[model samples]
Target: MILITGATGHIGAAVLDQLLKITDPGEVAGLVRDEAKAAHLKAQGVQLRVGDYRDPASLERAMQGVRKVLLVSGGADEDGLQQHYNVVDAAKKAGVACLAYTGRALQNPATLANELMVRHFQTEEYIRASGVPYILFRNILYMDTLPQFVGPQVFERGIQLPAGQGRVAFALRQEMGEAIANVLADSRCDNRIFTFTGAATYSFADVATALSELSARPVVYTPIEQPAFAARLHAQSLPEAVIQRISGFLTDIKNGQEATVSTDLADALGRTPASLQEGLPTIFKL
Candidate 1:
């Protein structure tokens, strides 16, 4: 049996969808924190197991009879890391055969976002040290981020960012999830680190241009200083920590740190991932 954590989330839900079509419902289990939020998944025939990453006992119960585990990273920050470790420990005790984890793109030890990368590396290390077969999907930034960042302003104003002319290899979350499901379904996916990306690389300006075309408005890309950008986000009632983290990510983008694209996802899924154009309609509708 295969167990999927974070089953209510975007990528996790997509993974669950793909797994259902290829595997029997009885062979699939969903580890979710809130059973109420998972009513839809339950209706779809997934065996629901209520579990919280902070609670080791819950994880053990969730992992019962599970052969493969997909450990989706929690949403919170440092506390989330601890929760992930707890889940890994429980998975170890449950004697799961293979564990798959999500990670960042850069394998390089030196980079601005390397700190985030390190956390994922630590989880990967734990899975490896546990003597379980593991697969690491080093995912790129989500193409969905474009809509989240700019969609709100589509009708009122335009998009603005600190990413000066930097390019990013952003893949669709659905595609990433599908690639993950493909990996989990195949026995040969053990002990591999696959870097996932879209078919093309895009700059912030390119994103604004696409939005402009889709919305039929003058979508402008404005680059501002990191401190100023953070101040703006702060004025908008965003948490200081979130503002700082976003500023740091934009700084990394401006430094050309996230420009690499890969064919690994296509190779894994036997198909090309969705493009920005294909994803624009749904994103713009919101």
Candidate 2:
């Protein structure tokens, strides 16, 4: 059976949805902390296993008889890395043939200068050292995040962030999920690294232009200083940790860290992933 961690989450659910469309439902399983919450998945003939990344025994139990496992990275808290280690160690001990992980599409981890990317790099290294066949899905920023990053009043407030002219090869999260699912089901993808990115890259300026055309509204992109952005977030009473993460991401984008485009997503789906113009409407609920 193929077990997916974080199965109820957006990416995990999307991966399961894509997998069920091509593979038999009986061959798939989803790990959830509460079986009650996963009743919808159970109704779809998916075997539900109760597990938590914090509990290694639960992960071991969840991996019983599972040949493949997808380790969806956890949250940004201090325990996140340890949670990832728990999953990987459990997967290795369970004798799983293949372990897949979703990480950032960073070219150089040693000098990424971002805390989140660095943590992802550490997790990837731990999985590699486990000696289990693994596939690393290096995912880029999601189009879905545009709404959250820019906020609900994009056309009204315009775009103001520290991204500068840095471009991001953002793909729809659902499409990334589909590509990850396809890779998990195919042995040819095992032990390989895939960068899931859009066929093209776009800067915030390009995004503003696209929005103007799509919604027929006067949208503009303006660069903001990192401290000012942090202050805005602080005035909203956001946590310092979250502020740091958001600031770090904007800095990464400013440095052109996420600008690279790759064809791996398209190749896995056997079709071109949605372009920015095509995806923005859905992202913005337009």
Candidate 3:
């Protein structure tokens, strides 16, 4: 059986959907923390296994009878690395055949110089040492998360961020989901790292133009100082730790960390991945 962690989430759900098409639904198990959120998946004949990354016993139970597992990376918390270790330890103990992890596209040195990348690298190292065949999907930034950078006042207050002229190879989240599912289904993808990315790169200015075109509103990209940006986020009631983490992301972008473009995703999916222009409409609900 194939077990997927975070199955109720966007990437997990998409992977589940794609997996169901090529495999028997009963052969797949979804590790979920909330059964209520997994109602639709359960109704579709997917086996629901209650599990939490922080709970090793639960993961051990979920991994029973599971040959392969997709260990989706946890959220941006200080405990995330430990949680990932917990999953890896459980997977090792359960004798899982293959373990796939979703991580960041770390091409530039600038990208690796942040707390986010540090944690990912740590997890990758741990996974490698776990004695299981693994696939690392080093994904680029998601175009779906552009709204967080553009802010809610984009149409009215225009766009503002600390990222200055930094381009990102932003891939569509759903397409990424499909690509990940494709990897899990194929045996040849074992013990490899895939850089899942879009066909093109876009800067914030380009993003503003796209938003302007899509929303038919005057959207302008304004470069702001990091301190000012932090202050603004603070005024909005964001935690200091969260604000610092977000600022570090912007710092990486400003340093041109996320600018690399790769065709690995296209090669994996057997087609050119969607660019920002084609994906913007769907993401912004235009």
Candidate 4:
């Protein structure tokens, strides 16, 4: 049986959908914190196991009889590393045959988001040390995040953060999730780390142009200094810590650190991943 944690999340749900298409429903288990939140999945024939990363016993219970486990990272928190460690430890005790984890793409130890990367690296280390075969999917930035970053400005004033001409290889969350499912199903992917991205690279201006084409509105890209950008986000009611984190990420992009596209995703799925243009309509509902 395959146990998928974070089954209610964006990528997790997409992974579940893809798995259901190729595997028996009885062979798939969804480890969710809230059983009520997973009623739809339960009705769809997925075995529901109540679990949480903070609670190792819950993960242990959910992992029982599981052959494979997909450890989706917990969302924005300082304790993300600890939570992932708990899940990894539980999986170790469960003697799962294989494990899969989602990590960030191109996260260098010296970069601004290095702390997050370090946590993932640490988790990978633990999984490897536990003698369990594992696959680490280092995913690129999501095209869905573009909407979250650009939508408010478009609705209020039709502006976007012109982070210069730097390119970002962004992919649809569903595409990444599908790739994860493919990895989980493939027995040959043991002990591998795949960095996944879209089929093409795009600059921030390119994103603005696409948005303009989709919305039929003239969206303007406004480049600003990192500090100024952080101040703007702060003024928009974002918490100071969040503003800092986002600004740091934008800085990394502006410096062209996260631009490269890789073919690992295609290799894993045995098909080309989706491009930005192909994913635009789905993201913008155009």
Reference-based TM-score of each model: 0.93, 0.98, 0.95, 0.94
lDDT scores in order:
0.81, 0.91, 0.87, 0.81
What TM-score does prediction 1 earn? Answer: 0.93
Per-residue C-alpha lDDT of model 1 across residues 1-286, encoded as one tens digit per residue: 8899999998899899999988888888899989999999999999899999989999998998999999998774777778878988998899888888987775354667435546777777787887878888888888887765654765566657777887888888888988898888886645988899888888877877876777787777777666677777888999877776777677677777677688999897788877776777676672
Q: Using TM-score as the measure, which candidate wins?
A: 2
* lDDT value, candidate 3, whole model: 0.87
> Number of the top candidate by lDDT?
2
| Candidate 3, position 217, lDDT | 93
The residue-by-residue lDDT of candidate 4 on 166-253, one tens digit each, is 6789988888888889778776646888999877888877877787877788776676676677667778898877776676567677
Q: Once all C-alphas are superposed, what RMSD does model 1 give against the true structure? A: 1.9
RMSD of 3: 1.5
Clashes in candidate 1: how many?
0
Backbone Cα, N, C clashes tallied per candidate: 0, 0, 0, 0
RMSD list, candidates in order: 1.9, 1.1, 1.5, 1.8
On TM-score, who's better, 2 or 4? Answer: 2
Ten consecutive residues with minimal summed lDDT in candidate 2? 106-115
| Model 3 misplacement above 4 A | 108-113
Score candidate 3 by TM-score against the native: 0.95
